[model samples]
Target chain A: MIEEFFLRALIAGVGVAAVAGPLGCFVVWRRMAYFGATLAHGALLGIALGLLIDVDPVFGIAASSVLIALIVTGLQRQGAIGGDTLLGILAHAGLALGLVALAFMSVRIDLMAYLFGDVLAVTWSDILWIYLGGTAVLATLALIWNTLLAITLNEELARAEGIDTARIQLVFMLILAVVIAIAMKIVGVLLIVSLLIIPAAAARPFARTPEQMAALAAAAGALSAAAGLFASLQWDTPAGPSIVAAATAIFALSFTFSGTLGKRAA
Target chain B: MALDKRSAGTGLLVEAKGLTVRFGASSALDGVDLTVSSGEIVSLIGPNGAGKTTLVRAVAGLVEASAGTLWRQPDLRIGYVPQRLSIDRVMPLTVRRLLSLAGRSSGAEIVSALAEVDAAALLKHAIHDLSGGEFQRVMLARALLRKPHLLLLDEPLQGVDLGGQLALYDLIGRLRRRHAMGVLLVSHDLHIVMAATDRVVCLNHHVCCSGAPESVRHHPEYTALFGAEAARRLAVYTHAHDHAHDLAGNPVAAADTNHADNEPEHLS
Candidate 1:
C-alpha cells in the first residue's frame, strides 16, 4: 500500500517538474517572480471557491488566476497604482477571503492537503489532469515561442516588427494562469511559486539563451522533484515543501559553483 | 504648421504635422513639424535639450504624439537602432540570434545585411561581448533585414570613437544607396553631422531651421547653436565624413563665432 502511494506521488512530481521548467523561464526573464507569488496566493481563494461551489479545484484555481492576471494587467495599463502595491493587496486579499470562505463551509476540510499538498494521496484521475493540463500549456507555449521571446526582449521592437504585443501579452498571461492552476495541486497554493521560480533560478548559471535556460530549468526541476520524493519517503516529510527544499538546496550549490566558474570564465 | 512649396514637392515620404509630445508637465516636443523625402539622408540636429530624442521616439511609436498626426506610407515599416542597445550582458546571445528577434531572415539575407555593415565576421560571437562599434554595426545589420522604408537611428555616433564612426558612416552610405530608405539619423557629433548628412534640420522645441547642409551651415541660427567652426565642418563632407575634398576646403570652421566664444562651459 505504501509503495503504491509512493509510485503515484513520484508520477505527479514528474509532471509538475515538466510544467514548471519552461514556465519558470518567463518568470525569471520578465522579472515576474513577485507576480507569480501574488497569483499563487490568489489560488487559495480559488480553492475556497472550489469547495463552496462543489466544482473541481483546478478549474476554480484557473478561473481565479485568470481573474487576478486580468486585473493586474488592466491596472498596470491604466497606471492607476504601483504594481507592487496592487500585487500585495490582491495576494493578501485572496488568502484572507479563502480563509473566511473555509470557515463558513459545513464539512470538515483537509486544510493541510491544500496548504502543503498530498502527493501520497494522489489519484490516477489527478495524474490525468496534470498531464492533460501540462500538455495544453506546454503546447501553447511552443506555438507562440518566438513571438513571446520577441516581446520579452523589447516590446517596442516587437510592435515595430508587426507582432501584436497586446495579444501576445494576453496569451502569456493566460498561459501563466493555467500553469498556476495546475502547479497549485502539486505544490499546494502557498508554495506554488517555488516550483515556478526555483528550478529556473537554479538553471540560470548554465544557460546562454532563453531556450537553453528553459530546457535546463525543466531538467533541474525533474531532478529535484525525484530527490525530494526520496527525502519525503525516508523521513515522512511533506512532499510539496520537501520538493521545494530540495530545489532550494540545488540552487544554493549551483550558485556557489556558478559564481566561481563565472568569475574564472570572465 | 505650414510647409513651403520646396518642402512639399521634394517627394516627402514622412510628414509630421504639429507633433507635440509631453512627459508630465514638461514639453519634450512642442508643435514640431518636419518632413523627410526619398533619396535624402536627413539629420535631426539640436542641443542636449532640443527634443531630438523625443521627436525620434514619437516617430518610432515608442511614445505617443500627444496631439499631432503622423502621415507616412500605409505600410511604413521603420527600423530602429537605439542610442545604446544595452542587454543584460549576462544573457548569452549571438548576433544572428539578435537579428532573428527583429524578424525572420534567411541565412543568405542575414549574411548580406551583415556584409553591408562590414560585420559579417562577428555573426557567431556573443553579442554582449562585442565592442560598442561592432555592436552598432550588428544593430544596423539587424535593422536592414526588415527592409525598412524609413530607418530611424537615435544618436548612432555617440560613444563610438573616430575610426569606428568613419566605418559606420561608410556602412550607412552603402545602405542608403542600395535600399534608398529614408534615413532620419540623430547625432550629437556636430562635426560628423556637418559632413555626412544631405540636409540638417535644427530642432529646439520646434523646427528652428531646415535646409541643405551647406545652407544650414551658413544660417545664423545654426552657427548660434554650434560655433561657426562647427557649422563649416558640417558643410564639408559629402555624407561620407571621410577626408575633405575640393568643395570641403572651406576654412570657415576655423573662424570662431562671436557668440560661441562667450557661452558658459557645458561638459557633456
Candidate 2:
C-alpha cells in the first residue's frame, strides 16, 4: 500500500542507488570525492533557502548545488587557488551558512531529517520523483559514457578526437548536482557522497573494463540499499548510515575475494 | 619561406601558416609554418620549453592557435599518441577497451592493432598495471586502431628502452609505408629520428630550419640553435654510414643498420 512508508522508502532507496552506482564511478575515477562532498554540503543551504522562500526543498537543493558547482568550476579556471583549497572553502562555508540560516528561521524546521535522511518517512510521490530523476540521470550518463571516459583518461587526447570536452564537463557537473540533490533524501546531505563513491570503489577490483565497473557498481549499490534497509529495520538504526555501512562491508569483502579471483584469472 | 606547391598539389594532410599559441602572457609557439603531406614523416625537434609539444598539440587541434590559420583535409582522421598518458588507478580500463574508444572494431582488428606494435600479449591487461614501455606500446596500438590519415606522436620514445625505441621506429616506418599516413613526430634528439623522417623541422619558439635530415643538420640556423658542437655530432651521425660495402662488394646505404650504432646518449 502507498500508506506503508517502509515500502515507499525501500523503493526510493533502490532507485537512487541504481543511478548513483554508475555516476559514482566517474566521481571516484576523476577523484571528485571532495567535489561531491562540497555539493552535498551546499545542499543543506539550499534546504534552508527553500524553507525561507516557501519553495520545494528538492528544487532549492538543486539550485544551490548547481550554483556551487558553477562557482567551483569558474574559480578553478581562474587558477588563483588550488582545487582542494577551493573546495574546502566552499564546503565549510556552505555548511556554516546553512546552520546559521537555520538558526534564524522562524519555523521549527526538523533539521535532523535533512541532516540524516528519514527514508522511512518517504511517501509515494517521493518514489515517483526518485524513479523519474534516476532514469533521466542514468540515460544521460549512458549517452555520454564514452566521451566521459575519454576525457577522464586524457583531456588532450579527447579534445584531439574532436570530442566537446567542455560541454561534456558542464553536463557532468550538472548531473552530479542533480544526483546529490535527489540522493540527499536517501542518505542525507552528510553521507550523500558515500552513496556515490563507496559502491564504485568496491566494484573496481572485480571489473576489467569501465562498463563492467559501472554495472557492478550499480549492482553493489542496489544490494547495499536492500541490505541496509533490512538491517535498519532489524536493528532500529538510521537507514542512510546503515546503507553506507553495508556498502562499506561489501567494499571490504571485495578486497578479500578480488585478490584470489585476480590470481585465478591470471 | 614559400609554401611548397608540389606537396599541396599531391595532397597535404595538414598545413599551418604563422601558427602562434600563447599561454596567458607568454608565447608557447610563435610564427610557425609547417605542412604534412600524405605518406610523409615530419619530425619536429626542439629544446625543452621550445614549444615542440605545443606545436603538435596545435596541429592535433588540441590547442587553438592564437594567431594563425591551420587547415586539415576535410574528414581527415588523426590518431594522436600524447607524450605522456597518466591513467588513474581507480579507472578500470584494459587495452582492448581503450582501442574501442576510437570506435567499435572487431576483436581480430584489436588483436592486429596490438600486434602491429608487438603488444598482442597486453590485450587483456589493465592500462594502470602496464609498465612505461608497455603503456607506450598500448598507446601506439590505440592510435593504430583508428587507421588514421595522420599520426601525431609527441615524444613517443620518452620512456622506451633503446631496443624498444628502434622497434617503435621500425613500426612507425612500416606504418607509414603500409598506411601511407602522414606522421608528425616530436623528439628531443634529431639524430635518432633523422633516418626515418623525410623532413626535420627545428624549432625554438619558431622554425629555425627545416629540410632533409642532412641539410637540416648543416643549416646555420640549426647550428646556432643547437650550437656548433651538437650540430657536428648530428652531421657525423647522419654521414657515418652513407657509404657501405655489402657482401657482394657493391656500395649500399647502411643507414638503417647504422641507426643502432648512433643511439644518442640522451636516449640511453
Candidate 3:
C-alpha cells in the first residue's frame, strides 16, 4: 500500500476536500478568506517549532494556528487596526518567521513540500491524521450547524434567541485552525485557503439552500481532487496547484448553468 | 381592547427600569423606562441617533444595559425582526431555511408560517432575490415561526411601499388579535402607525414622552422632541381614520371632527 503513493495522495486529498467544503461556506459567507490564509500561513511556523521541539509537525501546526486565531480574534475587538491590515501583518510575519527558522535548522528541510504540499510523499500515518482531524472538524461543525448558521445570518438575532454567539465564534475559529493543520499536506499552506474557498464559491450559484450548497461544495471539491490527481499524473504538474486549477474550471462552468437557473427563480 | 386587557392579566411582558447603555464615553441610551404588555402594540418613535434601536436591542437582550434592571416573563419567547439584516448575495439561503434557524420546522409549519405573513409563495425563493417588501414579509414570517409571546419589530415597515405598509400593519394587527403577542415596534413613519399603535413613546436618548397615541401627539415633550408641525401632522393622520378610537375604547367623534376640520389648515 505504501508503494501506491498517488492512491494515498488521492485518498488524503478527497478527505480534506470533504471537510474543507462545508467549512469553506462559512469562510465565503463571513468574508474570512484572508483569515483562513493567515491561519494557513501560521502553520509553517508551527512546523518549524515542531522540528525545534522534537514534536509532531501536525500538533505544532494545530497549536500555532489556534494561537494565531486567538490573537487575531483578540486584536479585532480592540479596533486599533483594521481586520485586513491585521491579517496581512500576521500572515507575512508568520511565513517569514517560519522560513527563517527553517533556514537556521541544522537538519536539511524540503521547504517546497511545506509551501506547495507533498501529497505524493504522504505516508499511511498521514492518512490517519487527515481523516482523524477532518472527522473531528466535521463533527464539531455538524453539532453547531444551526447555531453557526444563525450567527452567520445575524449575530444579534442569534443572541436574542439565547445562542452564545461569542463562544460559537471562538469554537468556529478553533475548527478552522484544526482544518488548516490537517490540510497542510494535501494543498500546502500557500494553497489551503484556495481549497477552502473555491469549491464553496463554485457551488453557490447552483444551490437553492444552505445545506444544498454545502453538499454541492463537498461534491465539487471531491471531483476536483480526483480530476486534479489524474491531471497531475498525466502532466507532471504540482498536485496542489492542479487541484485548485480544476476547482477554478468547475467554477467557470457553474456560471454558464447557474445564470439560467437564477433567471428562472427570479 | 377591554377584552385583551382583561385576558392578559397585569398585561406585562417586559419591563425596563432606568435602563442605560454607554458605548465607551457616549451614552446611546440613558435612563429610560419602558413597559410592553401582551395584546398591545407599543411604538417607539424617534429621529436618527435617538437611541430607538438601542432601546429595542436592550429590551431584546441583544445588548446588555450598563446600569438598569430589565424584567421579562418567566417563559418569554421573543421574535425579533431587525431593521436591516444585510444578507450577503453569495450565500444561498431560502425562506424555508431562514425559518428553520432556531431548529427544524416541519414543511407544514413552514407553509403556515409563510402564509401567516402572506408569503407562502415565497417559501422557495432565495433570500437575496426577494424585493425589500417581500424580504420584510419573510422576516416577519421567520419571527412568527418562533411562536413568540412577544414580537420586537424594528422599523418593520422600512422598504415597504405605502400600500404594502398598510397591509403589513393590518397583518400585524391581526397577529396581535390572533396570538395576543406583545409587539414593541420602532417606527420612523409616525403617520402610518399612529392609528395602530396603542401607545407611542417618543425618544431622544431618553423617554421624552410616552402615553396613549392621542396624548403623546399633544405632549409638549413629544412636540419638543419632534417639531410642532410634525406633531400636528401626526394628530391629523391619527384623526383622519374613521376607524380610530381612543385608548378607553370610546369613539372620539368630537376630537375626530375637530382634527378633520384642522387637517386642511395644517396641510396648507
The runs of at least 3 residues in candidate 2 whose Cα sits more than 4 Å from the true structure, single-residue gaps closed, are: A1-3, A260-266, B1-9, B104-108, B214-268
Per-residue C-alpha lDDT of model 1 across residues B26-50, encoded as one tens digit per residue: 7788788888776578888755676
Best by TM-score: 3
Residues B92-115 of candidate 2: C-alpha lDDT, one tens digit per residue: 888888888866678888888888
Alpha-carbon error at B35 in model 2, in Å? 1.9
Error of 1 at A124 (Å): 0.9
Residue B138 shift from truth in candidate 3, angstroms? 1.8
Chain A TM-scores of each predicted structure, in the order given, are: 0.95, 0.94, 0.95
Candidate 1's TM-score reads 0.85
For candidate 3, the lDDT comes to 0.81
Q: What's each prediction's TM-score?
A: 0.85, 0.85, 0.87
Would you give the TM-score of chain B in model 1? 0.76
Each candidate's fnat, listed in order, reads: 0.33, 0.90, 0.90
Task: Record all residue pairs in model 1 with backbone atoms less than 3 Å apart, i.e. clashing.
Answer: B194-B234, B196-B239, B229-B253
List candidate 1 segments past 4 Å from native.
Answer: A78-80, A260-266, B1-11, B22-26, B189-194, B214-268
lDDT of 3 at B102: 53
Question: What is candidate 1's fraction of native contacts?
Answer: 0.33
